[model samples]
Target: MDTTSVWRATAPKAALPSLQGDIATDVVIVGGGITGVTLALNLAEQGIPAVLLEARDAGFGSTGNSTGNLYETVSRGIHRIIDRWDKDVAHAVTVARREAVDQIERRVQKYGIGCGFRRCALYRYATSEEGKERVEKEYQGSLDAGLRVRWEPSLPPPFHPPHGQVMVLDNQAQFHPQAYVRELARQAAGHGCLIFEDSMVLEVDTDQRVVRTVRGKVSAKHIVLATHSPKGLHLVQAGMVVNREYGLATRIEKDGFPAGIFWGSGVDRISARELGVDDETYLICVGEEHKTGQEDANINLDRLEAAAAAHFHVRDIAFRWSAQNYAAADSLPYIGKDATGCFIATGFETDGLTWGTVAASIITDEIIGRDNLFAPLVKPSRFSPVKGAKGLVEENVAVLKSFIKDYVTDRPGIPLSQLMPGKGDIVKVAGESLAAYMDPNGNLLLVSPVCTHMKCKVHWNSVEKSWDCPCHGSRFAPDGTVIEGPATEPLQRHFLQDVE
Candidate 1:
């Protein structure tokens, strides 16, 4: 029941002080995930003064919650990219991602980061008849994307053998993401980059290039909003689809676990991998993706656990967590300056591990006045409604629906006294709807159910104990504190006393 990720719980910690006073630097990177930390290290090593601000510790976001699989293919399948754009664009995406993975390998070797970095083969197999066809298509897509792929008769032991052929891609890699990002932060700090932890940016003044936290602020010429989906409402958020995926890891075992990235197909879509890091081993399985804030978290998580148990003969589930991803309307991540003029990296979907590195490389080049070949492809300014019409329309409709439900519908709310212990709900208080949560100690915490990012209604995420925005994926704590997503302001708080 400990929802902490296995990577985060097992990885060693690197404690860094929070930002104290006002400071100015050449470049300021927000959010200390892989992208921000990599950019900080790359910039500082080149004699550029940079600083990184993290709301929590490094890699505490989706980066650490990731499956830790590194490959050139996107999780949604590269074939869709080719169909949306062209074969050339898909090839470019794969090439850029491969280079980023190589760069990660180089860093692991150069810095001796003990993150269980290893080269392994990735296998894509199917279980049902429909899934068999999907594997065939994915195999063709991999080849079209200029990857070295082959077909195997069936999957090996420790796996439910495929219903048909298995597509194998060699040279794919995996690593301990939490450990790698933490090590990258340490190295960046050693290279003169001021890395701050637990310093959440409360305000971003784009006009003055200043970002202010609770107790400190940083002004920089170049601002990189490496936070997932970017902070505050951006034009890109209007064109992206946000989703959450579940991940679970089994108890440490000595052997009998598979040693590759295995992705199953169809309604039984599950991505599985084994890890041997820091003298520990775990079999990790991740899948079950749904639109954020729109689905029952407990049901989705339980379904994933059921599938994991059905497929793999693994140990007891030890750790369980989830990750949020944003897919762009045009099948590509927006990785550069937008209309607001700040560098933003988002919409990487579930393939952010490789895309995050590619984004860091591209953004670093742009700030240093160097040309990166892949920069123009994913620049945030590009508008391709013809290619992105599907996602754009869905995003707009979702926003409108949230607004209407929050403003138009007659919402049935429970009275404060009817709110049960260890539960949260929208309660009617003096004719106003407010988010109310009752603690185990019989204490009540109340806050507005409105998300500050875009005035969208917030829904309770039962699994994570937070309020999630169905509009833009912003999440807040039960106390109205901002957790993540594009919301920079916390929810409005309401207090009541002696009112059952």
Candidate 2:
């Protein structure tokens, strides 16, 4: 999805200039999103001189588009982790995540960030009877893992769990992710930390603990790759993360509605939250999770719109955006040293806001020579037998699919019969033709099949009805408006040619 409306709309102008000529600093932190900024702030508190650089503006990446759920619960199904990992490892992972959420709440109060943060309950509902049983089992596992949770029979609006089984975790919370990150940036800069915008890191020498960027280089005692995906120059960081996409958001009136965060299971995973800014209360609804960068596009938005209408009678969609993030197969993110002085923090799955904070805390502790309990659990190099085979199979399948999609398929055109009136099919649009799915009413929605930034074909996300870029994580609307980026430009429109 394009960044046209997602977090880009909420961005307050660039905070600093792009990296220019060469300069040196005590510590150079790459990526200015939530993870990097949070680390800088944490380091500042300890009187560490740090420098932050962004290829674009802060929050331009996954951090800006996040739904801002400070949740400890796993976004990837917990069942997968439990089945794949040892019980002790899974339990420790959950505890560390919960601790991270708690730490953010403390930071908000300690720094007076005032980012519209609120304590709320989060629910995961079972759509089918079988799913209900699954929820019950997971709820028990969570209890055994020492989490605060309750199993209920029903959920609030838009979702009636006929299975009568839902898992509710209290003290879970939500906030304006962009606002919170901006607050952290402000505090970091105030503490003598230097920030450089538009400074993309080109290389990293872990042996020397130096990061080289387009603008300059910084030699520090340690380096952190807080970039959403590890931008490895000489080392392999791919195993640390897997990327995925989320649906567009429509703003809704929050009146007489239960206040909190919500998600339901099915082919169409639905998520919603009641958000407020000043005097306005809006509902942010999202879903349609697919492997990051699938081939289908523009369908995710339709699913989101339908969910909104069914649940909230949504009158207007004030903001529409898409997001991509790395989800570690083992559940916990890779958050520790890579080489002598190099550190990495990726694959927070769907809860980067909380996970990013935890990453900062752990990495900061290591840099400062302090002992942190989470270090062992979130170690970057820890090997899991479960992730080895399953992850390998999944990755190979994805690569094979990409090959077939790139070399075999006749992309010049698709048949009209493949498209139902209400459903969209990707065809040539503007200069590029890709996935374009329709709604129940058969409105033609067009999007770029190729990602604006990385050229990987965007996938039509049926669950959410939006075009999702598999490479570099960009999303676009049916009309070609960007919802997220590594790509700043809106997708070129191509429906006119289709009509011709």
Candidate 3:
């Protein structure tokens, strides 16, 4: 089971050059995913000179690995939005999401991105009576939010029908996100935006508006922290909770699969969508979400595979991948100037593909000195004591527990020779906890188990072959390179002899 996403595996490679020497621009964007690339394109279209820096290729992060469902509705659902805020706010959020989807459609057609963009309906169904009641609430909420929704007693086939009830939202979409983003990057570059790939940003000096990479420096009037959860910002990081979800693409007979985005209601929610790759169609199923670093990826993958097999006719599993998303305490993404005067965007949860584009639209407006109506809804500095207080306390308590437990517990007192090939463990060596992974060739790779973000212990992710921090969701490769962040530094590598 390859952990690489089907989007990344199928899309053409990005050819942007890496940053070199010192460069200056009007704005410096850190990250190359959908948010960063979309922001770059937005600014470039307005004749702004922006430099987009990516540690890897465009769309290589969560955007490429996303299930690629573009929705006007969110995972928390419309009813929850109404409960959390008000009917007006919920309606406004729905409008903004619809605008974001329209913007993506416009761009794809205008630029001819060839990203397999298609408009489809979205169906959310229930399996139990309680689930059906929840779906009914969502249907009413959708109507209250000014969205056209239909309540059906049964859903179309390929989906197990005769359950409880279903709520349908029309005009939703899906696409090859990598292709869309890479094309946006290419267009941005053509419009005089400098796009750099494989250029890791080391530090950001918000006061001076400067970003430093290992080999180059970028002096800009503004900086956008589009690096998923906004690394290096303690205040913003504290207001969010991270969760990891698994996705699998399985081969489906052409025309045999149903054409719509399907979501099940309840704790164990399952989402499925039909996707066409080359001439073959693949049924993309995603679910099994858990707190980052709290559960085994293999178990989640098994659950996803089992769900797919039960619902539809599967030819073969084509791809397996996992993605992490941040959930803001207030249930709205933070997309405005932080306390340090730097622009930031994060906490999109399962709706990142749509909300990320919305963030881009807002941030781009801010950078261009234009007023955006939705800016206040997602302001980074805004705090809701009533709406967000409970979530804030619960999430931080979990983080605190992980930090304390990791430090107090002793690592396994096993010798390195006991590690099986392709296996990893946290072992005690020289009275210190070290992470050890043995490759197929019998070479032992060791690194400090302590997370660079907040000194929390990193657990081994067997499915992705990475070390994931439970506290802030920073992830590192087996050899200690940073993959995801709030932590800019890699895990400290140690030699076998040094650990012994």
Give the TM-score of each candidate: 0.98, 0.79, 0.97
Ranking by TM-score: 1, 3, 2
- Compose the digit string of candidate 2's lDDT tens values, residues 133-206: 66677787677666788877777655554466678989888877777787788888888888777776666677
Weakest 10 consecutive residues of candidate 3 by summed lDDT: 408-417
Clashing pairs for predicted structure model 1, backbone only: none
Residue 440 of model 1 has an lDDT of: 79
Task: Give the alpha carbon lDDT tens digit for every residue of 164-225 in model 3.
Answer: 76888999999999999999999999999999999988888888899998889999999999
Task: Identify the candidate with maximal lDDT.
Answer: 1
lDDT of candidate model 3 versus the reference? 0.87
Candidate 1 similarity to native, TM-score: 0.98
lDDT of 1 at 318: 81
Q: Give lDDT tens digits, candidate 1, residues 88-198.
A: 999999999999999999999999999989999999888677798888887888889898999999887778778898999999999999999999999999999999999
Give the backbone clash total of model 2: 39
Candidate 2, 327: how far from true, in Å?
2.3
